[model samples]
Target: MKFLFKTDYEDDIRLFPHSGYLWTYGTLLVLIAAAPFVLSSYLISQLVFVSIYAIVGVALLILTGFTGQASLGHAAFLAIGAYTTAYLQQFGVPFPVYFLTAGLLTGIIGAIVGFPALRLHGIYLVIATISFALIVEEILARWESVTHGNEGLRVKTIQMLGTTVPRDSAGFYYLCMGVLIVVILGAINLLRSPTGRAFVAIRDSETAAKSMGINVSLYKVKSFAISAAITGLAGCLFAHKLTFISPEMFTLQLSIEFIMVILIGGAFSLHGAVLGAIFIVMVDPFLTFLKDDIPGAIANFSMLMGAGAERAAAIEKSTAAVASANGLKGAIYGFLIMAFILFEPLGLYGRWLKIKLFFQLFPLYKRATFKRQKIYVKSERNR
Candidate 1:
């Protein structure tokens, strides 16, 4: 219901459109600052996961959401960041230098991939990214000298300045939260710049963007590089958070989860990335709890269905089979993605906007106020 009337050009482009936004954001910042002391260690760890995913989610949003370019292999960039951090630490590289280096290396690799992928579109681009992910995984597994292969690599203690922050400590949590805030602010600023507008123009219509004199190819590569750099920076934090990582941890499924975060939360908006990260992190424990209880629940149901010894044995076997279906998490993610695409394409953020608008308009709001509209151009049909 809040409204802001712009009186000058500065008001139109200001980061905080009104006093309400300023106060709201300030309150959120205060809450984040106090979270470490108020929340338990387990909850803080979960928040760290949220922070890590939020960073990566913002990166994906830039490329896939803002630029209309799909990358199914972003997890590879994360792995590159993690491994780079790990290897650099062995040579006694300072934390800041190694962390920045990870991002730089991954950005270079992403631009390299983007260069060859400029000719592809839609599913073809997706396939190329997926192939890139697979190739990276294979290389990580085979290159034992550097990556340590399937045996995995343990991260050394994280040292910044003269202080060492343990993974389980609140200092580490603050580090992650601080980095996430910086990245979010940077993204907000970037999207307000001319470069960000060009990316959006390419996404909406490449031909039109080209007609406007935008360097579509160069912008696409730049988007990839920037996205990869942010994602890679996130991976550096992720490596320290877990203190151990292997090729398996950066699988295609992980990449899909990153995509799912943005898709479910809302792709076009930066807030969507944060919301998606929170949803994913909060839902994870519930899924784990369900995984633990499902077999017992199935067994109980089977017992209720029959009472014979043979029936009991059959029920036990069925329970075991059902219990072993850890793939249920992946299935849930896939289902959510399909549901969002078909029924609620704009995602959680879009739904929230509708609700807010409906309340703001109250009695004047029509049922069709938020309905989707189709725009059909006769010229395109004729062609």
Candidate 2:
């Protein structure tokens, strides 16, 4: 509902486009700060999970959404971080040292992978990344001396400035929240910088970005490193939260969930990452309701209506069977992803924008306000 008429070049570079953003985001921060105090301990842990996944979601957006480079092997980078931290812990390495090492190591590996991957695009690039993930999975399984093979490595509590912090404690919740805040701020600043602009350019068109004097190859590699580094930090938190590390933990499905986080959250938005994380974290409970609670509710209703016990029981059994069928959860998630791709490509955040704009414009709004345009040429910018 708000409009800004830019009169100066500085206006475009402002951190918040309008006063509304400042007020709304400020309110959000206050709520997040009070979450630990007001929410249950288990829910606080869920918040920690959301924070960690949000980090990974933002990283994926940096590479796939902004840089125009697609990746399916992000789980490998995540594994590298977890294993690096676990390995370093054996030597009693400090938190800062191990954390930095995890990020740097993953970044270097990502850079290595990005160079060869630059030659590939679209589905080929996806395949290449998935191949990388498979390779990392194999190495983790084979490298028994370092990764402990199939046996999981237990992660101890966080060692912060010499204090041991439990993962579920309020202090740890604060730590995770703090890290998420920093990462979001850093991402916001990055997107505002020239480097981030270059990423957007490359994503729109590598040939055009190169024509414009941007080092496409260099920026692409940098995007990979930056994205990988962010995911690495998430891995550290994820490992600690799970209290275990194994090759099976960082599977292709896990990497797909990271993509799901970005897709459902809004691939091109920083806020999307956080929203997607929240959605992903809450999905387990939702799936449980669908699988277990729905059947029970139906049974109760049927019995209340004086239906025979046999019929009610049969109905419940059939409903439970269908809901609990193997791959139903994945199928539902995949269907939703497909639906979004087909009907709401811009994602949840995009849908929110459209709805808000419709209400603001009332009868004046047109269907074309948020319509998607087909690109005839990949080298041309639609943004």
Candidate 3:
């Protein structure tokens, strides 16, 4: 009898209010589209990274978030796609054909790797995928003639229909935005389909899903292929945009970053991916600045270092730049993962949806209970 008060079927069915979703997404889309006009060049550049992460986050959402498959080798797929772009350019292949070939090739590799998932789960599966990523890195670093060893390869300027796209920040931002919109819409449509249902079912319970006549193995591999294909496309864009490639760029860190994007974003939610990407990318620089300012501002730091003010300033700047380039991002990423798990498991989008729904259903509600929950524990509690 106590359990009845704790659970509500009607509430479960009404978890995502229709009006709220519409208003929230509609407003978000408008803001994203208008960002270029109001944002700084640096911000636009950051937004380009956000867009790239959005695409990768969506891919991670499909495999790990939607299908509940743990993967730590996503960077390998990105590497495959990037290397393919470089390889095709070397052979003078057209961009369109090259991208298609890269996606297909990466998908094939993803499917093959996913085969092991048929018998593995949890940490075992994660280890296998991570091993696969390490192996890919080893190959990229060792294959001298093809991969150019540690020297890395330079990417050419993007040419579409004989016109070279501008290599500046604004052009790249717009290009990334276009790709992001298309990918997001495509992801939403896919998740609304039968295949998407199968993936979700498998995520919930592979045994039950298999019992219901879904081929678990086939769907798992198929989901991985789709996820990898999307990541591959993002990689192609990333490689072309940077006009450079190296094995170091597609390391295990890259894979961890993709995972962080989705985890920080709500799992199994499309908007969460975009929201997570935006928040994470924007916060990265701020964290780096904080790291630099703290050390420089400390009184003990000035006393301990006999170095002159000029040297100190230079050291501070260099350290700040290094933090900005790498260390700060990882620390913040880890912090975000932990924080989201503790406070907002559904991520920023989930919180936004809650606010939208609350306003839409305000004044009439008798109980203090929210129509849509944004808090971390709400998912399990709602269930």
Candidate 4:
């Protein structure tokens, strides 16, 4: 077991707690830098997706994790950022200008959304956000003049430093990786600052935060703006990656997946955001495997059980039917979300801490060190 005896105030907010963090984070950075050269193009593209989603996860982390605000319509912010980028591209704006503008616009919108959320909490907040998302979707569909309706907008290659950069090129991948790094660094600094600490206080107990003279409403709005800004930046890259933009792409389902990313990856940690992104991006491939292989396997199993040919065929057909349902994907996501809430409330990041502790403590470890208290309270309001 390693122990650190803090001797200075800087120790409390230092970026690297110890040398171990430097080694681990350094290795991770090195790998990210080398990935483009070693990985296949398809996998590289997936990494791009992961980076973008992870950015949004961090945004949600700021609002939902650190500040205890609930939003179910973050996809609206994403769509705004994406469409903003698409719209600006046609005007010949440089990448930096439009990119920052996308985030700024999204942040302003998020702050506006936060105003309505002030009186809401729990499920009500969720519903309000969902309504906002539906409104954005409808606007996107009806405002044919600018959005081009459901026909979508084509995103040409990005021009950086007066050079055309294709989506698959290493330049774009590095750009995303670089952005993720900057966002992570910025979030770390923010968490160590007064604003970040205020957010945490409000999350833990709004009433108590109010007692401390913290402006709960203002902080909540700030949190939303900051979170939305980060997500908007991610949207810029997302639009570029797909080379297309449409209202249908940023649906409620996508917003739910963002929630899933934070929940499953570790709601409280930046590391969780990256892990959640990987899991979310890979879900499609996993579902594809189920769709393509599971039915055939079921048929073979029925044959092994000595079922008649027609019965085996029927069994396979029914199994395929279940797998083919449009709702199956959503159902699986829902189940995973529920399971994580029930079994691992701390998420993948929490699980990681537990495992690391076990290794560190070895035979001296106790299960209760990471155990949850089965306590329930009947409270009608935030603590």
Angstrom error at residue 73, model 1: 0.9
In Å, residue 300's CA in model 2 sits off its true spot by 1.6
Q: What is the lDDT of residue 11 in candidate 4?
A: 93
Q: Where does candidate 3 stray beyond 4 Å? A: 1-34, 291-327, 361-383
Which scores greater on lDDT, model 1 or model 3?
A: 1
Clashing pairs in 1: none
> Once model 2 is optimally superposed onto the true structure by TM-score, how far is the C-alpha of residue 29 displaced, in angstroms?
1.0
For candidate 3, the per-residue lDDT at 279 reads 76
Per-residue lDDT of 226 in model 1: 95
Worst 10-residue stretch by lDDT in candidate 4?
374-383
User: After superposing candidate 2, which stretches have Cα over 4 Å from the reference?
Assistant: 376-383
For residue 132, give model 1's deviation from the true position in Å.
Answer: 0.7
Candidate 3 lDDT by residue in tens digits, 132-241: 99999989999989989789998887777887765454666777788888888888778767898899999998879989999999999999999999888888888876
In terms of lDDT, the best-performing candidate is 4
Clash number by candidate, in order? 0, 0, 0, 0
Ordered list by lDDT, greatest first: 4, 1, 2, 3
> How accurate locally is residue 380 in candidate 1, as Cα lDDT from 0 to 100?
38
The lDDT of each candidate is 0.90, 0.89, 0.80, 0.92
TM-score, candidate number 1: 0.90
Number of the predicted model whose TM-score against the real structure is largest? 2
Which of the two, 2 or 4, has more TM-score?
2
Residue 339 of model 4 has an lDDT of: 96
Candidate 1 off by > 4 Å: 291-324, 374-383
